[model samples]
Target: MTKAYFILILTSFVVAGCGTTQVKRGNLGKVIEPQESRLILSTKNIVSVGDVMLRAGEYSKEGIKLETETFNLKDSQTTSVKHKQHTFIFSIPSGEYLLYSQNNEGSYYASEQPFSGLKGTKDGYGGLFVPNGSPSATEFYWNWNKAPNVLFAHQAMLLTPINGSIGKTSSALKNKNASIPSATLTYAGVASAQVRFVYKEFTADGYARPAFTQEVSLDYKPGGTYAYKSALFKVYKADSTSINFEIINPLY
Candidate 1:
């Protein structure tokens, strides 16, 4: 049998200081020969743009053994490319594997959960007010009523057996309680496919927020075939005044 591999492309606009500033950011990483008895992994142009770092690991029932490789872009002088791509190569024994990429500062990885619930209150003078029970007027002034904001956004991919035996699902999978638009799935090859998820976010006052609807497309492929699946898409939010609770495991 031929060797199998997995590739991931993560793209986003870098936002800083309360989502005020936006900059283009991208990173690419891959794992080859995942299921082969022996494999080779390689990378290129990864450290050319923005600081780049790569990591590889083998997954098994026992545990995970990880190895890391780091490349510093800050120390090196390189021009920014409009469409720069990075590549990584590795050799390993046959089995399932995971790969990750990050910036030189050490801040990027696929995570299951990204954000946490609001834990503190706001006080007068826009300072941190430590009170309870949803910011009453006595505890906070109207100007001090600080709404939540998006701090960070993260994305990750999870692979599972296609025979429905793994019992794994997408992070943005659908549920009966939620309203979702119809989705289409495209089969790319034997082990890979794409699925798209589209939905809208409504406010507490019973109005649909403008530009609140989002579609997220994800690509899936097995170790065998090269078929392309339709893109799977989902929407996530940093904060919403109308929504009381954070949407948990949006897609189950």
Candidate 2:
């Protein structure tokens, strides 16, 4: 049992506020069989991008019926809109569904706590004045019957537009603007697999102090959709330790 699990990618959570959605995935009635129910949307780019959200839903047990896809940049010769790489094909009825992404709203699709940054704000602005060494914001789980049955929710970003020099420190022009002025919104929540970080020692009734920690799951399987095949999560440490949460994704 060599499970360490100590990985913290952090810095991503300006969450839910881009505006726009017509709602479609067979209108959420869930029934798209392109060859045995498959839904994929996670370009797996690595870097260089912004403002591209694609969410789909259906996984009921009293939760997860999401629907969001609002990425626009139509061009008529030149208004500056070079956004391409969209592959969303869905076929449902096999049961269980939920997808997530919001690469521009800073990042999203948290699975029930552990995405601190809550858009971050303990005082002043943006969790310890954001800019690389992010201090907070990481609580994703935008509600999908509580989210995380996992069909997909892969967000990739690399927003760049740092135009505001000369005594510039308006907090880096507010962490982003002018189409993401100096930004970043990486996906894979927070990782370092290798057993990451897991420390448990029981026999309490003594000393204990823990703050800021979120991760309900992860180990790989961030592959592609149709509910991939693996990448699952479930880490509940209670007995008497004070660590009762962990739920990675994929596995549909």
Candidate 3:
């Protein structure tokens, strides 16, 4: 059987009192995955603020199935899905598609490419504020017990760059939080060799937080490469300081 490698890059940022700081960071290089099989990415002390969970589901044109398992990176075994909101996870099947997400309150927060009706705007304090594509926002409470304000957004394409020719339909932000929107593209019938997982969260106080944006490139005949970009911003309360964060894959 052939061996597959999964690459993941986890980066985080915390902004307080008008200053930014980088906390607990590392990269999981090339995790081996068995061919014609499925593997879960696991880690220890990987998430500094909250628990890192994985949710998987098959992609279709109509919609996606929410009945998926939530796996913990700490343990390589299947776990329970505790969150009531839409759980985020990446399941690749050697194809291309557009990825997007929203906040619990039914707000469109993030996307791989620039999206209309959900762009960040400057607030009264000259801070850039962006809604989570929902009426209300959700919080991602890490192990530190710090409930970091969280938002959901996704990018389009599997292992290919989104070209301008694809037109406006190439990327879009959905209002409904649970609606998982994705698109599949063909690649010479060679099958996609790898899958990339990218996500970003922006606060309401002019601060952008980075969660995890990594690539899991599968090993197949004549292996291929993928590239993409993601951006998120946050706005702080009147008496609070805000920060912004941006995560770029391949960093090239």
Candidate 4:
């Protein structure tokens, strides 16, 4: 009896203020007009060109309830900085805001729960507002994780599994005394075989533990299709010792 071994491999909330700088502005018999405060949105890492949405207040499932604006990074005015990073500048009222990011294809990549914008500096002028880190927002760093996985834009993403072990299930046997399973196409006159499947989860740092696992007995013919949970695949060949299958929806 022969056994085939098939291996398949697949892969914070903080609100702080920028230090205020005092500037002396003499108002000697002169009326000083109030200038709008600027909020600098800079990113050192981005997956692709897409719209960046910012809404007043914190993120909620029912939505912002107020006016929400989206700015496309491609169309927004940006300035080049050191290390080829881009900085997006926005003039918004002083308040808390939530940020949502999505790719051009409408796939969400990142989300920032709540950040603040201040209106005054030590100089008694419009102050520059930013996240905990100024000039570079670490929350926008999408490339932090090198693993390939889906990105959800709404809220914090859950961890996923990686380097999952392959699971096998068989239904029939030909020789009771056979020490190993056979791959000769048929077993005990049964036109069925076993196929191995794997489960995976995604994470920002790397991968997460398996969401779940269950023991199931499945029988399929050569070149047949099957579905297990959200995974769909077609069996090209299967036997007691080895099986070959193709994932129909790899991204699902």
Number of the top lDDT candidate:
4
**Across residues 1-252, which tens digit of lDDT does each residue of candidate 3 receive?**
223222211122222322432222212112222122122211111111122112111112122122211111111111111222322222211111121222232212112211111122111100011133322212211121212222211222112211111111221212342232221111111125332233333343423355433323323322122333311111111111211111111110
lDDT tens digits, residues 222-249, model 1? Answer: 2211111221122121111111111111
Top candidate when judged by TM-score against the true structure: 4
Residues 77-147 of candidate 4 have per-residue lDDT tens digits of 11111121222222222222222323332212122221121232111111111232123221222222233
Q: Candidate order by TM-score, highest to lowest?
A: 4, 1, 3, 2
Q: lDDT per model, in order?
A: 0.21, 0.21, 0.20, 0.26
- Per-residue alpha-carbon lDDT of candidate 2 for residues 150-234, written as tens digits (9 for 90 to 100): 3332221112211111111011111111222121111222245411322211123322223322222335333312112232323
Give the range of the ten consecutive residues with the poorest summed lDDT in model 3.
121-130
What CA RMSD would candidate 3 show?
32.3
lDDT of 2 at 114: 22
Q: Is candidate 1 or candidate 3 better by lDDT?
A: 1
